[model samples]
Target: MPRIHFIAIGGNVMHQLAITLARKGYQITGSDDEIFEPALSNLQSAGLLPKELGWYPLKITSNLDAVVVGMHAREDNPELVQAKTLNIPIYSFPEFIFNESRNKLRVVIGGSHGKTTTTAMVMHVLQQQSFQFDYLVGAQLNGFEHSVQLTDVPVIVCEGDEYPASALDKRPKFHFLFPNIAVITGIAWDHINVFPTFEIYKAQFEIFISKIEPKGTLIYNAADDVLKALVKKQPRNDIQYIPYALPQHDVKEGITFITIERITVPLKIFGNHNLYNLHAAYWVCKTLGIDARSFLTNIQSFTGASKRLEVLLQTNDVTVFRDFAHAPSKVKATIEAVKQQYPLRHLTAVFELHTYSSLSTTFFKEYKGVFNMADSCAVFYAEHALAIKKMPPINEVLLKQCIAQPGLSVFHTKADLQNWILQQPKEYTNILLMSSGNFDGLDINELKNNFIHL
Candidate 1:
């Protein structure tokens, strides 16, 4: 058995990948500065948790067969330096994934907004057909035990992240996959820290397109102007390009009907964005030669990815949704989706500025007008977030002004925000809490219970 050590393995993806590898019979050991819940417990249960909390150079021994570096570790980590000195093989998380699935047909899903949902949709269809394939998705789906799954299956479906692999690897994670079938859901400027300019960000997608294997397929979102332009400019002749758009749909009484092959299918998941995601999934499945009707049937039951506009509490007149939508484009799309679904209801969109981009003073201006559709808008930020990120304090007034929604409100503390939420009259109101992080450890279930009981 190969002995592998994970450096900074307590991250959401890193921890899950470590556990998956350990389950595959690889002897996995990992370390992190501060291991949090779920990850800590999961690693401990698997007996892969490090004996110590912090990094130690001595842990990088010659006995280890390979070292997997996680994004959580800095470039100058002492353990990383020690590994380099020992001339041990080091792999980024994506590099290792590519190495594992080299012999399989790799289907990589990329984009800014709907990659998770699209990937989940494809996986759902494949699972319904009883097709055996490995996968690594970002968000948790309904039937999957872990977000990252590895097997000896013939195909691997991955949610391709455009983010940097690790401190040592500046290349985007998706660039290394060399996919046989690739999907770009859409391109919206994100990760301001990595790609500061929109042009630089778009270039990464181009690189991803170039990485497709010869005679492979490039599935793209035709509705996105940026992606469309990129596809048109691709000089690769060996690749086949497939374009997808929102399927024909009608909404009545908060339910969506998708028209596939002249047959209207009722869908539990609604919204134009989701419809587009479904269409993208259809094309991917079709590329793999799955019947269209069967794919649609399987997708009808996929509620959604965890926290992607997931409803936490619902009553006859009030609904509370929690979403992982911190990026500006995602926030706008989510707000529009909820408002479009419940046209008669007054939407109260509340967002926590949690990401480095959302919290940065330089990038706050990009979030302007994202919440214009909301009847009432509130932006929340925590002081500790700024301190920990080592960023300068953002002025609440500045954030509100930049967002520029009339009557926009901003809060720095969770207590005041929670009180405000509780006081709102519950008639025909939709409450959307959007963030990538918990709002300073607010109990979402408790909030939901209080709303339902009231």
Candidate 2:
């Protein structure tokens, strides 16, 4: 069995990969400065957790087959430096994933938002069809055993992230995958700490398109004007390009159904954005030879990926959903989904400004008109987050003014946010909690229980 050591294993995907390899009978060892719950507990459960935290260069030996590098590790990370000194092979997470699935058909989903949902949808349909395939998805799904899987399967579906691969490799993660089949959900400027400009951010997608294998297929979202223009500008004669838009659908009361010809398919997921994701997934599956009838039939059971508009609690008159929507475009799409799903209900959208991009004052203008659908809107940002990111203190008044939501409420404390939520009227209401952070360790289940019972 191959022995692998991870430089920074506490990352969500890194830990999962370690556990997966351990389960596959590989010898796995890892180190990290700090290990958080879920990742810590999961690694411990797998018997792959390191005995201590912090880097130990002594663990890097010539006997190790390879070192898997996590993006969280710095260029000068002691173990990483040691591994290089020892002449052991080093692979970024994406690099290793591509290495493992080099012989398989790679379907890489890329975009700023909705890629996870789209990837999950594709995985769901393929699993339901009982097709043997490997996958690496961003979030935990209903039937998946782990986030990363490696087998002798002939096909692999990956949620192609555009973030930097690792500290040593500054290229975008998806660039290394070199997908045979590529899907771009949409492009919105993100990761400002790295790209720093909208043009640079968009250029990454162009590079990704150029990286597609010769004569391979490119599937994209046609409804995204920016993405559409980009695709049109680059005419790839060797590649087959396919664009998908939201399929014709209906929302009756609270359920969403898409009708095609004489067959009407009911979906467990709601929202126009989700509909668009589903359309993209359908095209991907179709390209892989799954018939349109079987694709729609199998997709009916896909609720959603975890934390992507996941409905946590529901009552006869009230429903509460939690989503990972820290970006501006995602925030707007998520709120619109709930509003469009329950058109009669009062939608209360609460967003946590948690990510580096969202917390920075420079990117606040992108969110100006994203909250018009909410009957009531609240924005929360932990004060300590600013200190952690080394950003200047945010003025709540200015933030509210910049968001341009006249009656928006802004809070810097978790307690204040909790109180506001508990005090909300419960009749005919839909509550959406959107964030990439935990809202300063807010227990979502407990909050949902309290709200639903009240």
Candidate 3:
């Protein structure tokens, strides 16, 4: 059995990867500076958790087979330094995934917004068809308990993130995968802390496209102008390019109907972005030799990936949804999708400024005009976020001005924001809470249980 040590194994993806590897009969041992619940509990259940909480250099032995580094670990991590001193091979999470699945047919889904949904769709279809495959998705699906699964299966579906692989690896995570079947949903500027500029952010996708295996296929979203441009610029003649767009769909009584050639299927998930995601998944399934009809049949039941506009509470008069939308394009797309799905309802969109980019004063202007679709908007920023990012205090006045909505409100305190939410009229109002963080550990479930009941 290969002995693997995971640095910062307490992270969401890292824990899942460690658990998956452990289940495969690999001897997994891991350490983190601090381990949080769910991850800690999950790792403990798998018998892979470190005996203690803190990292120790003595834990790294020369006999260890390999070390997997997570993004949560810093450059100067003690365990990481010790592993380097012992000349142990260190692999970024993505790099290790590539190494593990090199013999399998790799399907990498890359994009800023819809990669999770697209990956989930492909996995759901394959699962429904009883086709065995390994996968690494960002969000937990309804049927799947874990996000990362590695098996002796012939195919592996991976959600390709454009973020840096690790502190030591400057390459984007997707760059290491070298996919056999690649899909780019769309290109949108994100992770400003790493990419810094839109041009630099878009170039990552270009690089990802270039890394496709010879004679492999490139499935792309034709509706996105950026993706279209990138696809056009591809110099590889051996790569097969398949472009997708939104399928013909109509909204009736707050539900979306997707028409696939002769078959019209009513879907539980609605929105243009989701429709685009479905199309991207359809092309990938087709390339995998799955019939379009069978793929569509399976997709009708996919509610969505967790936290991608997940409905937290719904009553006769009000509905509340929580979404992992932090980027400007994602913020705009999510709000528009919600409004378009329920045209008659009033939207009270609450957004948390949590990401390093969103908190940075330099990148704040990119969010301008994103919240104009909402009937009312609230922007919340935690003071500690500024301190953590080492950024100057975000000017709430400037944020409000940038959002440009007449009734825009900004809050620096969670108490004030919670009280404001509680005070709002509970009828015909759809609350969309958007963030990548937990709003500084706000109890959203408690809010839903208490306020919705009242």
Worst 10 residues of 1 by lDDT: 417-426
Q: Summarize candidate 2's per-residue lDDT along 56-108 as a digit string, tens digits.
A: 99999899999999978998999999998999999999999898888999999
Query: Per-residue lDDT of 1-454 in model 1, one digit per residue for the tens?
Result: 8889999999888999999988899988888899998889988998888888998999889999999999889988999999999999999999999999999999999998899999999999999999899999987788888889887888999999999989878889999999999999899888888999999999999999999999999988999998998998876889998888888999987888899887677898877888888998998899888987888788888889999889888898789999998889899999999999998899999999888888988788888989988998888888899899898888878887778889887888888888778877778999999999998887777778878888
Candidate 3 error regions (>4 Å): 449-454
Q: Give the Cα lDDT of each candidate.
A: 0.89, 0.91, 0.90
TM-score of each model, in listed order: 0.96, 0.96, 0.96
The TM-score that candidate 2 achieves is 0.96
Per-residue lDDT of candidate 3, residues 199-302 (tens digit): 99999999999999999999988889988987888668998988888899999999999987677899999889999999899888888989978988999999
Between prediction 1 and prediction 3, the one with superior lDDT is: 3
Q: Which 10 successive residues of model 3 have the least lDDT summed?
A: 396-405
Clashes in predicted model 2: 0
Q: What is candidate 3's CA lDDT for residue 159? A: 98
